[model samples]
Target: MRTSIVAVLYVGGWALFAWLGDSWWQLLVAVALAVVFTQLGFLAHDLGHRQVFRTRRPSDIAGLIIGNFGVGLGWGWWTTKHNRHHANPNHEDHDPDVSPAVIVWSEDQVARSSGLPRFISKYQAFWFFPLLTLEAWHLHIASFKALLQPTAKRRGLELTLLVTHFVLYFGLVFAVLPFGKALLFLAVHQGLFGIYLGCSFAPNHKGMPILTKEDELDFLRKQVLTSRNVHGGLLTDVALGQLNYQIEHHLFPNMPAPNLRRAQPIVERYCQEIGVDYLQTGLVTSYGQALRHLHEVGAALREPTREPTR
Candidate 1:
């Protein structure tokens, strides 16, 4: 039902943009689409987790529809990458989310980086939010490359859906507005969409404890310690797509989105009983902590006299 509303809004936005003159209305439509698209992407994430269906096939189909067709992302690629992240949340080498060239999560990673990467790592905290403006475009290009790789599975279907998404997405924009307006529309849509997506994800695990390959911890402890929940009510729940319950979601990846809130107390109590560090904070606080952690990791790079171990 919720997905239906989001889908309607997404399609309607395109239609409204096409009919409306090239003015503020068009930009408004782009912003609306970006918000709608981000929500659809969240639903797609739920599908990838098999939370929307009892069986894997139906979930995959839904993911392909919402993720590939609607959100212009490769469902197969996302599923694979996301699963790996779930399997190893903050493991520096194992988690793809931590392998950012712009921001180094660990001092070791920062130390290993050289030249441009090292330079960026020196002040990545300041550049983080601004750099996310281009993340949507980066993900699109990355998805295409991942889907086109010889090692990628379901190449034919994935590539076909991705290509179809591109054709329809750009075709509608070009058809509705002039070339210049279309470019502006695209920029607005993708830029806001990228920031929206990044803001939703970064607070979940960004400032959490980083685990080394040699580290050994129980599953429950690892999940709870590495994940941070954002404190909020219904508004945050809807905006973050239930990802505010990050600790619970990571501990139970297959749990449905709506159930996360209900399960939160249970998870928190269990963590308490087990003496685990269940991190929860306000959204702004979480972002601040994430930024601070990034800066802390890069501090050694800025001061040559400082020990890298610090």
Candidate 2:
């Protein structure tokens, strides 16, 4: 398959770079590796959604190999989390992606916050991209933690693959490069990996409406209203892994990445016919909208705390 061939090429490239190690230029390889890992993540996403394979068994096998072995991400854990996000894209309560953690997504969450999270929420919009540099580490940690949970399926297998990936990955870097350069390589690679991956997903639903229990809506409206699409051509499609068409992707989660673009016009027209709001914007505009929303949500935190009038 084409995907398999491309994956092989990426691995070969990494091997070649590893062999040619001990130069500052390896930092560039780190950048390329970050992009490579993100592409693997996209492929894993497709496998998770059964876009590539008809049966769950084949999909799970490929997902585990590509996700855990290839990208050092736990496929089981990611699928569990991602499935919940798809089931409820922007639901403040149900969606783990939007749930109050480091950054509060909703004003209600802002009220309940305290300590470090509260401080972060105050200027989350400003801190958003910078914070994304750590997103790779966050995901890696979360994946390991998920494997320890009782609910994790195939715990042994996933653990083995994950441990092996870290071992081989770290061993290779430290083996070939000096300790200083290895650290530098890791910083650049993981930081850019997180930023690039975060950028790809951020524009999908970040600025869109957040739903609550009281806000009842049908499936069609729920997905279309909460999702935003980015307008671009082939380059954009390849870069974002077809995620630029978030509305169509959300509506048809199992749709192949390539087909999502084809489905976009038809989906857009139907939404128009039904008088549903179809949100789409350019890439930079989409980030601006998301950041603006974050700023607006954190507005209350920016106000000086009032003292009791006694």
Candidate 3:
């Protein structure tokens, strides 16, 4: 209901602005759209978790609409990946989120990295935000690749909706704006969307513990120890889609975003009783910790390469 209202408003508002025609000022609208896109992404995430719908069919239907149709993300692919993250949190072997890629998350990953990734790891903390500008494009590419796989579920529907999204999105932008302005709008819109979405997810588990198969942690400990919550009020809650309460969210993945805040204290108290370390920090500090972890992970790369002794 509330999400429907927001979707209507976003579509109507975007249509109104597009109808008004191209102007340099539409870049501002692009910025605003980026924020809304992040919010919509969060909503899609909740849908994937079945927070909005208890049944699998309804949740997948809504997720496809919000993710594939609305945001050009592949619902099937994202949910598959996200569910694994939930099952394992930050497990080095199982969690896709922390997998070795552009940024190495652990020392073992650093050792495996070579070429560009290895070089980039040395300065990843500094390049983090700038690199996020490409995150949206990376996601889109991954979605297409996933749909192309033979094992992809509902491959036909996912591919059709994803293709339709690109056509409609590009067609609408080019129809309303000059080529140059349209390109600028896309750059700003996608770039900021990536950054905002990345920022929201980064604080949750980036700097927290990275688990491996050797670490035999209970479900509660695995989720709690590997997630960090950000401290803030209403504005932060809205901006982060209540992901500020990451510990609570991880523990209760299906809990609606609104209820995470209410669950926080209860979760925290239980953690206390069990002697688990509940990490909650300010937003800025959370990012700092994440960045510091990135830097620390790359520390070995930053060292002088040792020459082999004959």
Candidate 4:
């Protein structure tokens, strides 16, 4: 019930902003609501895995409703990709989401022969979201792919959810508010939400070693290899939707964002006992580091290594 209420509040807030709201303060409120919807992505993520709500039916309903209504993320596809990512964090083949988002890894043989090309490759990638609005690109591509997916036909709710999303978005974009103001509100709101999602998610797993299949022989091993946490102050936490604590969240997907701090010590001890490298950093320092590491990811991918189990 709480989750459902949260979902409604998110959409409701968006509606309020899209209609009568005005000024920078209202824009911030809209951004906050959008952030809530974005964070709902994480909630659905946990629920999809049945780690949040536990009951399969309830969790699935929660995930599907939030995913479709709040973020327009295809629940099935997101789950497939996310589970695979957990199973194989950075394996080039198994983990399709092993992003080139930032040039964080070291360059390999392929990049060495080239200079400007190498730099450009990394530079363009690091700026993927910021430079050219890759969020828009991703949404378009993902929407198209999901719509055409044969599996989507079997997963009947996808189209309904997407159409509802369109109705909501378009209703705000055209029917509800004045066109000019609505576009402006949507633009600012999306900008903040996009940065929020990208910063929170990209830094979570990006700089971590893109481990191979063999590295993730077990669940515990995969958690250690695939995940790390970031810690920042209250403002950063609020802005990033408490996702700076990425490693902790990954380890305990069911835990709400607000409780991560209290859970940190416990998670840290576990990481220590397991000998896991609990990667963590504060806002500015880690922010700079994440950017640098993103540029070097392509470099890391190319290092010579024996193949692992696929």
Index of the highest-TM-score prediction: 1
TM-score winner, 1 or 3: 1
The residue-by-residue lDDT of candidate 1 on 1-310, one tens digit each, is: 8788898898788778777966767988889999999999999999989898999899988899888888889989988999999999999889999985667898888768777777888898998888898999988999999988999988898889899999988988888788998899999999999999999999999988999978898888878889999988999999999998999999888999999999999989988997888889999999999999999998998897985662
lDDT, candidates in the order shown: 0.89, 0.90, 0.90, 0.63
C-alpha TM-scores of all predictions? 0.97, 0.96, 0.96, 0.76
Can you give the lDDT of residue 220 in candidate 2?
A: 96
- Clashing residue pairs found in predicted model 2: none
lDDT of 4: 0.63
Off by over 4 Å in 3: 305-310
Per-residue alpha-carbon lDDT of candidate 3 for residues 1-310, written as tens digits (9 for 90 to 100):
6697668767975876686797888888888888877878998999999999779999998889889988899989999999999999999899999987788898888888888788888889999999999999999999999999999999999999999999999999999999999999999999999999999999999989999889999889999999999998998998898989999998999999899999999999998998999999999999999999999888876777732111
**Candidate 1 local accuracy as lDDT?**
0.89
Count of residue pairs whose backbone atoms collide, per candidate: 0, 0, 0, 17
Off by over 4 Å in 2: 305-310
